[model samples]
Target: MRVDSRTLPLVPLLLGPVGALQLPLLGGSSSASQAPIAADKPLISSPLLQEQVKAENLMQRARQLYKIAELGEGEYNHPTRVIGSKGHLGTLDYIYSTLTNLGDYYTVSNQSFPAVTGNVFESRLVLGHTVPESATAMSLTPPTKHKEPVYGQLVAVANLGCDASDYPSDLDGAIAFISRGQCPFGTKSELAGKAGAVAAVIYNNEKGDMSGTLGTPSPDHVATFGLSDTDAAPFLEQLHKGEKVDGIAYVDAIVESISTTNIIAQTTGGDPDNCVMLGGHSDSVGEGPGINDDGSGSLTLLELATLLTEFRVNNCVRFAWWAAEEEGLLGSDYYVSVLTAAENKKIRLFMDYDMLASPNFAYQVYNATNALNPVGSEELRDLYVEFYEAHDLNYTFIPFDGRSDYDAFIRNGIPGGGIATGAEGVKTVTEQGMFGGVAGEWYDPCYHQLCDTVANLNLTAWEWNTKLVAHSIATYAKSFDGFPKRVEETSISSFAEEPKYHGPFLRQ
Candidate 1:
């Protein structure tokens, strides 16, 4: 960012030891920094922690992040912190460096894992002579090397294309048309390849267009791409009319296996046995800057961690910045999967922060009462509600679906709770009355588009939601008073829902 006229302390000096080096952190007056922070004292309280969360600091951090993503990420510059991008690497480096700079207060580590990374060059579908511009080639799908748009008869598949029986016997050398649901996108592609289809096209069940991934590369999979229901309507009508529908599908992408890292940091001063954990994913979709999608969430955690170094907590507060969440919650799933049953029990609770800021926004809380959650999750959820209600803010409860990074924690029977503004989901008229944004628009109109930059954020919503996050950190760091014991086996049920969201958007 431009350093003209305004010289502010970087992350290290945001609020120096709470008072001693007292600089106007976030433009606060000198007295604001000098308010009761000492090394020997047990500084743990909701108001005290919440007091440090400033809009100016948040705005400053967001601008820095926005600038990082704007200049482009990796080799292709298509990386908005997606796996294997330089931008993703930059985010990891920033988090690790900042936490490590806090002296002995935190134990920071970088855990690396291999993940399949891909960058799409071109993905398009052609019908007759018209090209549907909105159709996006599914990530990791095979690139069709055809120089000219090839023509093949279009045959629509049945039953979501999961079973082999759904394909027709005569569908050879044709494009397999399918609807998204009931199965993984890769499974559909494999089935189509075996059924003799040259390429596959999947359309969204929802109103807007979607971007999808095959999870990883597979030799048996055919070229595939995802489209909106609206874009594929014309071809479907022609096929039903007993008319010819010639199509060409092409996808150009560079796919490979590469190493990626997840950042984990924990305060050393609290009780390790009853550790309180919270985090958000750091990866974005290949399409945009992802500032609101997870940048807002990650920045909130970073700012809190910086402020937290000055305070002492009764229970440990651990923070994680997950990688590859946009590719199916890979980073978090990997972290939880390797934990021994005993190691999992050490965590008293886990809270997630995914999308805390959206252009058209309303406060959203995770449903801790869902059957899939652990016992003490409801109390954490209630605490978030308490914060909102105390401030006279309206909120709604989103389902504890496997769409977010919290999927792993809940499945392992850890108490998980979270707060979000939203992503992709349309705002209801009721939400419109509560938050005053456009009713029929997406909670984030720029959900996964190139438009999701610094200008896309609703700063007022971001400031409010981030303070709630700080309150949760402070409350749980102090004590787990009304929480129940973790006597149950990991969890109630697994995440068996169809069409799991790839980070913020539903993957076909």
Candidate 2:
């Protein structure tokens, strides 16, 4: 995920009014009942299909993904599967080859799209001849001053810098200091540039150090850097006391436009118009092997895709291994953006699975019940919750905000839902009692870190989450059943606009 925790509004509420997820009940959904029935292909049974999910099979693929990262395949063979790297290309090839081998079962295609990809070569923040403060260049925010340092007095922008009036008119050649919140870092940077600031320095609003982005580059954006809240406090105080905080903001990066690909595979056995799409990101962050952050989820989908070939489906099932997700859901966003209204209707649902095997595991269902998702979305969430309840497992719910791949689907009012073990969110004591892991620590301490290798996973959570994934997809494939049929209206409430972030998100 590009942003740590993103929370936005229901956007025009195309799916339903905020907190409303029910469409008027209709007769049996034509999505399944009307499909051609083949006698040789048995109707998908959830338990039977889930029973086929062997731990060894899941673990074997997990190891395979780990090996793909270490094989040093892409251009920047840093042993990480970051986008534009050979490791990610190798990952894409592996998925494509695996699905292609299924013979007539699937029609797999790779769709390429343009995106901004880069590496931060250098980042530093120094104020008034004092010791340098810890700082990082916001990802994809372009290298500063054509790789040259810019020196100026650091001026604090009033408020959170979400508004233009917050910037001082006298800030010519000064570095604008802004707090991060109520708007994107890119927005703040653009505002600063418009105010004649040479650069923008945004400090974290929350307690931890920053893990953020400026989304993609914009013409109005000045070079931008992120500072920790802890470090920003004293400087903010100094500026408040009518003191001069002369500073130098320097960020050197090689931000450039590059092409990335997303792998899409659809079952040939079911209705082509109605598909159940699911998968995780194929690319990882540049920092680590990413086996746990998403390798677990992506590979689990691979495991399910392979196993699904054994049976037939009444509704089409589409699988995607999205690219550039760490760069802010780029691949999935592009996929949805290009689809015609007809294409949007054909996609019955989009279920995103990410971070499914956290070391400190909590079976968190995507909180569709609380979100303003499409009418059928709560049913999708219910399916996962149903699985956990059936097995007598304790689980919780997470917001269905635009934090993952499903952001695009639901933005267009297509039903979306899925399961996750957990991410950087801390495990509560109550959850500690439920899942039995350390309470205060993160669900995955190695999230976005070098330690997120194959060994970082919890096999129990991995297998159980895998079964839940299988159950949800298999159930929908067999029949849309009691699920509401799609209705017709032509407002087209897409994700072109979105709610403000409580965390990081790509600006449309």
Candidate 3:
């Protein structure tokens, strides 16, 4: 669920109110429980369909997992369920343990993969007579420490610092003030460093304070910090008036590679040759516990899996809890890349669940049929529409642009579709009329921030969406009569390669 740059305000507010944050402890009993089926017993005769999908059950399960994510904090001096952390590993352990306890109903495996994780130990910026400004360190910025304040004459660069020519010749001992736009932040920082700038300060082109990665570290780059336009305006105005402005910028961080696991579970009793796959990222962003952003999606699948054990299926249903989705679609991409051509063809369709419980929610389905019409994508979209219409709910279509875990599957020509409430994107007047939320506010005000805890979720939206997940799973797991046939000879090389799309939102 990438944030669109076009939807962002010029002056974005601070990430969230600052205060002491606490991570939740993991030990607790789930709200919903089912006795495990004995390994020697015959399977149940009836399929527990949509009627059995309870909102209370979903909410309870979601609360249990949110508690696990809270346990991911303390270690990093911040509350985050980011991948490769204790919190996220606890999440994985809980999922694995739950499925394992279900006995012979399912076979679960953990697929290990390496991912680069970053942690910011310290980030600070002091400007204009030692006034400390709020700031965040960009991911992938090399560790940098200024033991003492290093004062430098501020030099304003012409245009956004996308090119070397934008840098002034006298930047050797000055701090370069660059505008954000037209290129990667790393590119701008590299150019500034090459021109001999001691450090680089990038102010947002829009209204808010800016925080972004320099992409990756470079030998030619120097220390860099992001500033909102409001914070930088006075300095820029003074510099333009031929007045010298001196400032101190400091940052220290550690970026390193770590191993993480993606949990894959499948029904032990369905057709292995043609499988229905559904997934949600198991990891969260560094800002906070991503209970709604993805914990809703992941736990939805987990709860569905638990309940689905009461029924049998004709087609195999596989669920994946992806890792490192926050750092890009690393887990899913790696999983897809390692699949044998035969393995790729065994998948009938892929459904993604990224953010399902936005506070000011809208029922947005992937517009696969009318827009990006990838193979059997239309059928998946239609299924969601039919489900909503039958329940007397209004629904809208979001573009089937590859922005979530579905991207890797669609890129390989496997038909895919999914649902999202909304994230960062503001609700429209028309949407308010249909879904009844504030028209101008974000669907999830706490998106990717410290506030995105269990309280951040809309239980109504989460409940309804979880039921929909069950409906979709039940519908497809029973049979793929209207869906496309598996392409036995499909080749990854034969498919048209689509560029990976990373939106400004969160993960893409």
Candidate 4:
């Protein structure tokens, strides 16, 4: 998604970027800084001593949970396929089991929300129009009964090219081919509808495959289909010649109740009057166990929850395990939308941990609005750096998007920031030197695949990341003076050019 320039802060003041930092601090050396560092207050002397002790105990318990999850998670079923059809029982059971391990330290409630049902429909231009080897089914199309042949004349429109205004005049009862351009996939489809076209197909203009969402429900009535560049080439070419063509929108639709939830487990003794939220999503794409896609983040949050269960801090810390994040942050959206004005005011911060255990990942911290980290947020990042320095780790910062639960908090004007291991297509060769890995493949090949089970975890990175995350949380809870009343933006673009540091400690 293209964020407006106004929404991103400058580059040097790092925001949304991710990476792996050097670990295992040497004596007198800090993990976050180039030199030895010490916190203004001792890690244990903070007002949240009880909480720190509880957190340490929770870490031990987390080891056991990891062992259990490792034993039970695997590819007996393809990851995506497993989620696609199951009742939410398996997932809920996992949550229940995780909570059971926490004993009486915290309350565990089973909250269920209504499920929005949708179907997957696919179409192809075969025999006549050259068809690609693979295609995606539209998210909203109803099931199709026949796998047999179906055809229709074609209509191609340049939705947003140099001459996008030249829309086809007579497109009724004809298929429409539109080049993927400036507007959203939904917008292209809506345009096709406005032009009186039947089926709509959108193709990528860039070199790689293009993915997008359609039928996003905006009080818009545009029944349309999306296509990859490879899939639309044939029919699109025909339309370029002003010739009629035929195609199919094959669909394998599903009609079931898919319930998603956001687990909010609160810690007491901290200021219940105001709270901090640490979160990550639990649901994965209908592909794999999502161990890495989010299982890493999910597990980290769970571990954090376990650690903070009985701890006492200055304010309440709520660990939220969200569901349906892959579905465009649905679970979090619901949570935020439901909060009252009073409830909104009570929230002081939201820290998101989306992906934090990839061996191939880069370190990133996000601050809301403009890619650069806001000044107040930068101070928090500095504190994190101090933690790293105290532990002897290397780290960097970049621009960010509050694309998770923190987003809701930011939208409501709450302070927030987060760390990510990494995701598809962001890390570069410089990062590879520091983190160690291939330069261009997906951050975690198992991201949304069935292989995202326990065994797939990068334990070294996992342990280090979890520790880093814990340290960050513990510090923030104990030291944050108060939420910033206002944050001035900073420019950080030049920081991107610093020859990404890679020393003996960096690894892929």
How many residue pairs clash in each candidate at the backbone level?
A: 1, 2, 10, 60
Q: Give the candidate order by descending TM-score.
A: 2, 1, 3, 4
lDDT of 1 by residue, 386-501 (tens): 88999999999998777788778877788888999988789999999999899999999988777778888898999898889989988878887877867547544553344376
Candidate 2, residue 346: lDDT: 86
- The local distance difference test score of each candidate is 0.76, 0.77, 0.74, 0.52
TM-score of each: 0.86, 0.87, 0.78, 0.71
**Model 2 deviation from native, Cα RMSD in Å:** 10.2
Indicate which candidate wins on lDDT. 2
Between candidates 3 and 4, the one scoring higher on TM-score is 3
Name the runs in model 2 displaced over 4 angstroms. 1-39, 73-77, 129-134, 146-148, 163-165, 205-209, 489-497, 500-508
Question: Between the candidate structures 1 and 2, which one is better when assessed by TM-score?
Answer: 2
In terms of TM-score, the best-performing candidate is 2
- Model 3 worst lDDT window (10 residues): 8-17
Which wins on lDDT, candidate 3 or candidate 4? Answer: 3
At residue 460, candidate 1 shows an lDDT of 90
What is the lDDT for 146 in model 2? 72
User: Which stretches of candidate 4 lie above 4 Å from their native place?
Assistant: 1-87, 100-104, 107-111, 117-128, 133-135, 138-149, 158-169, 181-183, 190-198, 205-207, 215-238, 255-257, 367-377, 381-399, 486-508
Q: Model 4, poorest ten-residue lDDT window?
A: 499-508
